[model samples]
Target: MWKRGVVIPGARMQRALEHPGTRRFSLTLLAGSDAAMRVQDEILLARLYNELVVAGRIHKTTRRNRFKGLDRIIVEVLGRELPDVPEIALHDVGASSGVTTLELWKTLLSVRPGRAHASDYYANMLLVRCEGHPLVVACDEEGAPLQFTLGEFVFSAGQRESLFRPCNRWLQARARARLPDVARVIAARKEGRTLPSGWSVEVVALWHPACRLAAAADARFTLGRHDVCAVMSPRWHFVRAMNVLNPGYFSPERQREAVRALAGSLLPGGLLLIGRTREEADSSNVATLFRASSAGLEAILDLRGGAENKELVLEAGKRS
Candidate 1:
């Protein structure tokens, strides 16, 4: 079974800084949901204190705002090709409040409608919440594209008054009909009789095309202190700020350097998504200007301690 949210203890975080491996961080726009936004704030604040003040880092001035780029990158990546049977993880480097942890879970469940695999190494905890019955049908890769896809789906929580309110409508009658089958699917996964190693699949109604298109673009530009409410989602897992700080203002040269650093921390097949403005549109050309910054660097630094080398996703780089 894949490990879920695990928050690093303060002592461990400190020890990690001393480790030789690269550190990962990310900055992206705030989520589009209320729960996600609230959670992100708490996570960002906590990271700022632990990473900046405690560690005496330089980007202290905008530590709280650095995650914007990471945010945009991740949103853009997922937006481009959301996993139908996807396994997503976000490392919260400066996760003081752990709000980012909570929001990540909410978004996975609410927005795309699927089961989530979460891990919070820092907290040393893992949880799997099954919402709206998820059906997992399998197939050989060559047989039928893994028998699952990453996209939006309709859900039906049954009760007219649901915890998700109207959004619960994302649930569908089909899901309700398959409730029995979905139960079996869940049971099989837990017993390791169905799901493959590190894989989960759920069927959901098609996600809104507009939202899909927007997700394709860099999402970091939309996140801000006032836009924290945008982070909410039903997918529950160990979520946190992409990185502790946003590097939107760094110079082109520095931004590229930061991206290199962040990319070093990601795991194999892992992603570092974030938002950033076009350089040509940037007027001041200040290293700290959000409009003209490198999304890759910002996202990498925000991730909590872990395997620092996996892959990188930048606006300047390929969206895939």
Candidate 2:
């Protein structure tokens, strides 16, 4: 099934698999995959974060509090305004790592046969060639995959000072060193390859606890890849586009197109909730609700802990 962190074969991977020339390619990268992790074959920062979680520096629970205000908006505004609503057909788009939808099933699915669906564009299947990366296989002198056990490595000042260490640990540490310069590395790649700054990391998976729990909780909670301006599903009662259609990531025209699609994806009298989370998982988020009507997607309410809705209304007016 579509389990988060567990990638299933998709169009990108299928294309690679069907081709004869570059068939060794495997994997569809996670949506918005960290650029730093693509340089080397290890996710050092993620590992460090995982370490923090283990040490109690980080807590790994579904931060359901983020959606509390959105929930209120749903019940008070849409539930009351609609007057004749029977069920809610909802979609949470741009749901990064599925973290925003965690613990949502309790209120969404279990509440007397509720109807809602979620969406996200997971980084596409990532294709990794195992030959270059030593961790995936053990090669003999002739460079053939061989039977293996624990892998060893040497980490020290020099040939004389080198100390033996486990290969996995060394790789993990090597990954951390590249974190600070990753943004620069991405810029360099975009400009040109002639510059000397070149390194890569490989992310085989994204470990999202929220998505996993949601998938296991109910089969109705669908997970799939969707670009905001190009979602090809039928109309929904409500669509929540969070942290996706910001001006920084998309140009004005592109943002307008995305807004058009979001509005079009809603049924008449349906609600469209849009927002961006500012800091950590705090409630310092900015959200606005627009209800689809004959006048087009009309801004109906400015949500709590959200920015002024005038800005949202202005944007919608420009598009309208």
lDDT of each: 0.31, 0.48
The local lDDT score (0 to 100) that residue 89 gets in candidate 1 is 46
Give per-residue CA lDDT, model 1, range 120-182, as digits (tens): 212111111244423322221111211111122212132232444343333333334444543
- Give the root-mean-square deviation of each candidate in angstroms: 21.0, 14.5
Model 1 bad stretches (over 4 Å)? 1-52, 57-79, 112-258, 265-270, 274-320
Candidate 2's TM-score reads 0.55
Per-residue alpha-carbon lDDT of model 2 for 151-254, expressed as tens digits? 22211111121134244335535533433344344344457564332344233333354455566677766566566788455568778876666555556776
TM-score of every candidate: 0.26, 0.55
